[model samples]
Target chain A: MAEAARPTFRPAHTGFTDTIATVVVWLIAIIVTGVFVWLLSDIIWHGIGQVSWRFLTEAPRNAGRAGGIGPIIVSTLLILAVCIAVAMPLGVGTAVLLAEFTSSDNLFGRLVRRSLDVLAGVPSIVFGLFGNAFFCVYLGMGFSILSGGLTLACMTLPILIRSTEEGFRAVPDEYRLGAAALGMSRTSSLIHLLLPAAAPGLLVGMVLGMGRSIAETAALIFTSGYVDRMPQSLHDSGRSLSIHIFDLSMNVAGGDANAYASALVLIVILLIVNSVASWTSDRWLHKRIIS
Target chain B: MSRSRSDIFLIWALRCCAAIAGAIVLLIGAFLVIESMPALQHVGITRFFTDASWHPSADASQGTFNLAPMLWGTLLAMSGSVLLATPLGIGSAVFCHYYAPSSIAKFYRRLIELLAGIPSVVYGFWGLVVLVPLIRQLQPPGPSLLAGIIILTIMILPTVALMADAALTNVPAQYLRGAAALGLSRWGTIRGVVFPAAKSGIITGVILQTGRAIGETMAILMVCGNVVQTPSRIFDPIRTLTANIALEMAYAGGDHRSALFVSGLILLALIVVLVSAAEVHSKGRIYG
Candidate 1:
């Protein structure tokens, strides 16, 4: 009866079909991997010789064809500083509210999450327009680093808030229960306990936000203006590294070497940030497991 | 007493932050709408949809503000990229999840993340220098709709592959075991069981990437040849709505600037619709 219950015979050609499918899957994987390797190697092979100490320290002499990216580097850092300073407080506060203060199904929390989802999905070009209209024109900031930084702050908030919320949520409930049972004040407990425990998540979110802001081109092009000179004040127009790369590659003839070097620098910065993020998270996880 | 007061203050601050974060989206929408009003009133809304070309002139009377061609171009590039990326992305995810050894899978995961981190402009530069020249060998115009599609496919592949990996990982192990107990082959189990379980997630990933492809500007602008027309062939030079705004906004003044804002408004609306669809399709995952 048991033998009869099973299929009397196996389906024919199943082996052939399975083998074919496996081969197709393997081919697809190889192709995808091959593309990635090709892109990275191509950039590195052409760009490596151009990256040098002088290239990193001097301003361009002949329309970005001759000099290093010193001023551009300064501008990028200043804009990034302004972006991080603004985004950090707002992002963390919102994340705390959603993860700690409100229930999952709370209406306000849901609304905020939905809005973030929409904002995250918004095209960066739309953000560029909004920044141009609201920050540069309406606010009378003109085309300056201040406006660019603010635009980036707005763009980075969605990702930062979402990730930080996830980070806060990951803290085990037992810790919260223990803190409350010990008569620790809500504020003190949160400051001393929850924040430290969630540091890895916070770091990851900040790194991701920084990466996105640093890579941004469309949003900064109009708000920051196209000035490659070192900006003395936040109000001064400045150019970011990504914008410089864009101008160099598209508008400037014979600017390919500098463009390649700039791209290589950008990729290296992103790589370091990414590794730091993963390394911190891994260390944190190991520490927790050990304790 | 002071500590409790500070706690109260902290709570209020957080609430304010949350409220502000939510309100920013509305503010952006409102601003875009207000900025676009001049074009809407001057050119009339129907002209945007009905006109045949996108020739924005400083003189409103002389300009034709037809956005249809660019709109079609945007959709075409988006759909074309999504079509090419979907199979490749899902296939790679399947390979990573089931076929590769654990060590190889981990390495592949890192590789995809690194791919995602590369900036759009860098990709554009690469596409312009390498991909365009390669394509031009076969076709006269190197920067065409095909180039845009290829760049976008690479850009959005990571998004789809990562999301699909998550979805596949989430599939209940019991289902796989049950399939094995029934003597189903590995391929049969994946096709009949894993795919069905992860269908919603995979669909959501594709939709999300579609939004990404639609919004992408710099790469498309760099490689798409920036011609304002509905492309009749894959090799035809085309302009996306995003490229249109970025290209003209710099010198555009008067009604022309307003017309560019109108394009931004449309992109915003399309994004909202896609995001809402994704949320609904994901079936309450937002709250979860």
Candidate 2:
């Protein structure tokens, strides 16, 4: 038995398998990321040098050479503005209700919470269908900027409410009790105390929701018709960057440069919005830790 | 005191906003049901479920809106994507948790986060230009089930990886250390002890990822080729329920509309089953 114990270092040449697995995993991660980059490269490699400030300012090309995304840009900003306007009050208002006044398991409260989750889960295309039927066919609003913005507002509502609710809950109950000791009502305490503390976080959630809305394509495609024109009326159809990229790529007839360039621009926009959100959340977390 | 009363009233009113958001969801389900009723009555539920025949363009006199083909296609594509993504996702997660340098793991997390950030439509476009061509090189046609699976798999990789990594992190270090102390190698300890402990979480993540695959629409529609036929083979073209609904919703008439709603209901049911099972399995067991 002592002699047998001496032979433990036989070393079964397992290096090959371990090395192979490590390399394979690393390569897969690299290649997957590279493909995403390469997609942008394929488009910008063709169209980046061609775009100018003028390209961003002018209306889309009618003659099919190389026009700008001015209308798409304006429309996107407009829709984004409209969505923010709708979602902010709606989302923060709901969050405050859940955090302060509503009792747990209240039927309507539970229903609202569950509904928000379900709304978050429903596919974008389904939302598109609803918008088509309810907004276009039933409401007679047609495929316009207003319809698209309203639908987007609905899409962003859940994120805003959920995040804002979390923000409100994070504020200490001690603060509320202290405010009450000073003859402040729950609402007064929330407005003057709880809300200010929650403001940074509620704002972050709004940015994230806006990013999600901006990056959205399927929901907007049917709700907002692929109108190439700048919006003159709320009823006027307008193209956002996502729609423009989808449309151009579908034809393969529209220059590949335009589509790729549009995608690159849109991706950059999303990154900016998402980063702002991430930064905001991080700052709040750090502040909470320090205090 | 009057100010306080107004404040309390404001809070009560704010609560209604939350109710409205939730009401919107129930309304969507109700709306879909109502819109599809005409088709439901005309076809009779039996034919819609049992029959594999779908001739949307067929003469109405013959009566056909068979969902069987579309359902089969949906399952096949999801199954295909799950098969491709799950192992890679788990592998990546394992590497991130146990093997990669701290910097590398952080980078990997950020990369996956960015991947998740890309809109579904961009994935759709990439599939159109790049992935389709790559698949065509392997097979003759540009758009096939293979292409759809490849795109969907890539699209879901970040979600699965993030969840799996969280699961792995949740595994206790004590078990791994105890295994190592007893005379196991690092890999051996991980393979034999850590992974088993993480199994419930891993399995739940896999099921949830499957649910996501089942429900995904836009990226899938772009590459699925949108044909209405039973999937014959791995490489054959097919139409998924989501694709069918997207492609036809513009002008679907009568039972054709209800057939689409039935397709959606089927999808919702599949997701509900997967989610409920995971919920039960994961209730208190998952560490992360």
Candidate 3:
């Protein structure tokens, strides 16, 4: 009512409104950050006491109620090894094919891209079902590490392919033209130049895949029988760290502490792997900038 | 140089490897259909979808493999979590993009990424230990759909927020400047300009979150007491398809196992639809 008399360019309470907006935004940000901090502190506080050299190296006793996760660690690593072995080559090859060999406008390329998207969204539990039906029963692997590893490999493939493809696509056309101008064969050029350039970015993908493998629980439950001991061979059933955490927390008496400890370890490993991934990629970018 | 023998062989091999990647999706679908065929044939597809009961091992005279309850539970939990998460995630993104100082925003974004990178099983553990207990003080029978929904909301928040932040950040600054030139308030500019510009992306993020929520197993399984009944209230126990498979597949055999495969098939179908919808939505935006 008094706006004309006041002769003000802005509303009277504009500053107040801005303050309110800032408060609300900060409140949300803090709450979100608070929840994460709480979760982390809870795990670290409870789990820190349990991490010991013996805990890392010794075998479980009395059905995993009162022992270490040594074998679980080994089995986890072994399954990861099997997974990366299969997924790395297949994923890198697929990425190379999509980025280099095919045009995105073509039907085959479109179909492959769509299929990759669909695969990326496929639930881990379905992978478990597939692993059970195809690898475990039909293939008669019988709830072994091989079945779990194979299933995880399949699950990791999409992540690997997508990231690697992005890495390849990020390589400018000038690099390829430069190589071709040198009279090098296409295969030789790709092998010597493009792949190495993409390797650092692909490492990020591999680390992410490794993180997924480490974190997986539902997919491995049925395929990898919840055995507590060290695996004798690829055919032998074994428990992974995630599965052990699940089984112990749910099944064993007084297993919550152990579960917490295992979870803490898993979280720490994930953080380290992810940081390593970013750090390596950052280092590569830094070098590129410097040069 | 002309293409060498090794070059041709390498190209052929790489193409085959690419085909293998595509074949994986087809293979999973084929295996699921094949494994589920027996159950589908026995139950009749219509009855399987319409039946209210899910007794896979009933007497030959009274076998009812209705999946309505699990389906309902999955939809309820997924939608509930997404509804709870969407506003919060988008709000966080808005704050990060338009409100916060750069240093604060950077730290906040890092925290969100850390949250995203935490494993689902640990979330399950936290739900079982911290969240459930906290809920118990307010409500009895803490392991309920509400618990599952809350845990899912937390799990998916980082993803949705990150996607939304990217979308919001990508909104051309010219629009913001134009809105300011028109004397629009900050929230007004965001509502009228930023939101419309980023509509497709936010929907894609929401759809992606839905896919993850529906497929979520470990945390939901731990928090949502696995009762194969229709949940009437937020505090009621319910089962999701993912949880059902994870809970029963261990000891299941015969038709029960095949029936589990059918559940997996349904989940696969849901994911395929959601993912393709998201893909189409993103593609449409890319051109327009």
True contacts kept of 3: 0.60
Docking quality band of candidate 3, CAPRI definitions: medium
Per-residue CA lDDT of model 2 for B198-288, tens digit only, reads: 7888888788778767777777777777777887777777888877787777677666666677677666667657756776788722223
Rank candidates by lDDT, best first: 1, 3, 2
Q: Rank order by TM-score, top first? A: 1, 3, 2
Model 2 TM-score is 0.88
lDDT of candidate 1 over B152-185, digit per residue (tens): 9999998789888878877887787777677777
**TM-score of each candidate's B chain against the true B chain:** 0.96, 0.89, 0.94
Q: Which candidate's TM-score is highest?
A: 1
Error of 1 at B12 (Å): 0.9
Q: Which CAPRI quality tier does the interface of model 2 achieve?
A: acceptable
Candidate 2 lDDT (Cα, 0 to 1): 0.75
> Which candidate would rank higher by TM-score, 1 or 3?
1
Judge candidate 2 at residue A274 and give its lDDT: 80
The window of 10 residues in a row where model 1 chain A has the poorest summed lDDT is A1-10
Q: Write the per-residue lDDT of candidate 2 for residues A1-291, one digit (tens) a residue.
A: 000101111223445555676677777777766766776577567657757788788888852247888888999887788778887888888888877777766776766765675576666776776776677767898888888888888889888988888788888888888898898877667779999988877988898898889888777877877888888877888778887877787654855677777777888788898888878888788888799
- Candidate 2 residues lying further than 4 Å off, grouped into runs, are A1-24, A63-65, A102-108, B1-3, B49-52, B57-63, B171-184, B192-205, B284-288
Instruction: Give the clashing residue pairs of candidate 3, or none.
Output: none
TM-score pick, better of 2 and 3: 3
Candidate 3 lDDT over B4-106, as tens digits, reads 8888998899888888888899999999999888777777778767776887762323567878899889999999999988988988887777777667777
**Model 3: chain A TM-score against the true structure:** 0.92
What is the TM-score of each predicted model, taking all chains together?
0.96, 0.88, 0.94
